[model samples]
Target: MSVLSALGSINWIAVLLAVVAYSALGGVWFAVLFAKPYAASLGRESLPQPAQPALFFGGPAVATLFVVITTATLMAALNIDAAADAVVFALVVGVGYLAANTVIIAINPNMPRPLFYGLISGAYHLVGIVVTALIVVAF
Candidate 1:
C-alpha cells in the first residue's frame, strides 16, 4: 500500500497512546531514572535548568509523536497486524535506525561522554519503539 493509504488506515488512537507512552518513558528515563548519569554524560555537575524549558520538553514530545506516527504508518504499509511481527519489525527499526542514529548524533564535538550518552539514549529509543509497536498492533 502507498504511504498515504497506510496513513489513512492507521489506528489513530493507538498512535496517540504510543506517543504518550514513548514520551513518558523519556521523561522518566532522563529525569528520574538516569538523571545523574545523563548529567555526567554531558559533563555537568547536575541537570541544568534550560533557559528555554519549552524547547527542551516540547521538542522531544513532538519528535516522539512523529516517531510513533512513522512506525504506525510502516506497520500498516507492511501489513504487520500480528503483535509478534510488529515487535520484530520494531526491533529492526529500533536498532538499525534509532539506536545507530542516536549513537552517531551523540558522537559530536560538544558531547563529553558520547558513548555513554549514546548507550542511554539509544536504549531508550529501542524500548520506546517496542512499546509503540505493541500499542500499534494491539489496535
Candidate 2:
C-alpha cells in the first residue's frame, strides 16, 4: 500500500495515544531523570525557562504527534503487523538513522560532552520509536 492508502487505514487515535505516551516519557526522561545531566551537557547549572512556555512544551508535542502520524501511516502502508517486524523497523530507523546522525550532529557542534548528548538523544529516539510502534500495533 502507498502512503495515501496507509493514511486511510491508520488508527489516528492510537497514534495520538502513542505520541502522548512518548511525550510524557520525554518529560520525565529528561526533565526529571536526567535533569542535572542534561543541563550540564549545555554547560549550565539549570535549563532556562522558555520566554513562551507554550512554545517550549507545545513545540515538542506537536513534533511528536507528527512523527507518529507519518511513521504509523508508513507502517500501515508497509502492512507492518507482526511484533518482530515492527521492532526491526523501529530499530533500523531509530538506531541507523536517528541515533547515528545524532552522534555526528552533536559532535560536530563541539558539545562539551558529545557522547552525553548522543546518549541522551539516542536513547529517547530509540525508545520513543519503539514504544510508538508497539502502540501502533496494539491499538
Candidate 3:
C-alpha cells in the first residue's frame, strides 16, 4: 500500500488530537514550568516578545502539523496500530534523535547553561512525542 493510503486508514481526528497535544503540552512546559529558565537561556529577562504578530500561533501550528503528518507516515510505514507500539516508536525517535541532537548542538562553545536547555528541550520533545503517540493510537 502507498504510504499515503496507510495514513488514509488512520483516524484523522486522532491525528489532530495528537497535534493539539503537543501545543498544549508546550503551553504548560514553557509557560508554566520552564518559563524563567528557558527565557534566561535565550538571554532574555523574560519571555521575549515575538517580532511579528502571527508568531504566537502560526509557528507552533505549522511545526506540530508537520510532526503529526510525519508520525502518521511512520505509523503507516511500520504498521503501528497499537498505542504501545506508537509509544515505542516515538520514544526511539524522540530520545535517539531529537533529545540527543538538541543536547549536542545546544552545548556548543558559545552557549551558556546547556543543562537547563537540555532539560527543558528534552522534556518538551519527549513528553510531546509520548502524548502525541498515545493520543493518535488510542483514538
Candidate 4:
C-alpha cells in the first residue's frame, strides 16, 4: 500500500546487487581509469577524495541509498512485475541522471571536459541499468 511497503515486497537482494554493481563500476572509472587525468586537467594534484566514515563507507553507501530510493519509488508507481520491465525502468532513470549531470556540468564551466565527463558519467548509469536489469531477471 505505501510505496515503501510495495518496494519491500520486491527482492531486496536483487536491488542491493544492482547497487553494488553500479557503485563498483563508478569506483573503477573515477579511481583507476580517469582519476589522475581528470585531476590534472582540473589543475589539481588529485581527485577530491570522498568523505569517509559516513554510511556504508560513504560514497557507495550514499549511491546505494539513492538507487534504492529511486528504484523503490519507481516500482511502486509503475507496478513493475517482470525483470524486463525493470530494465526499461532503469534505462528511463538513467536518462534522468544523464540530464541532471549534463545540467550540472553546463552550469559549472570549471568542470572536466564535457565529452569526457559525459562519457564517464553515462557509463555509470549504463552500469546501473544493466545490473538492475540483470537483478530483475535473475531474482
lDDT of each: 0.92, 0.85, 0.81, 0.64
lDDT of 4 by residue, 1-139 (tens): 6776766676777667767776776677667987775455454645465555655456765766576656765676567767778777777776767445644673466764655556556666666665766565576
lDDT of 1 at 123: 94
Q: lDDT tens digits, residues 71-118, model 3?
A: 777777778879789889999988987788779878977767777788
Provide TM-scores for the models. Answer: 0.94, 0.88, 0.82, 0.66
User: Clashes per prediction?
Assistant: 0, 0, 0, 0
Poorest stretch of ten by lDDT in candidate 2? 43-52
Q: What's model 4's TM-score?
A: 0.66
Candidate 1 has an lDDT of 0.92
lDDT, candidate 2, 30-57, per-residue tens = 8898888877776665657447578878
Candidate that beats the other on lDDT, 1 or 4, i.e. the better one: 1
Task: Name model 3 segments beyond 4 Å from true.
Answer: 45-52, 104-110
Cα misplacement distance, residue 45 of candidate 2 (Å) = 3.4
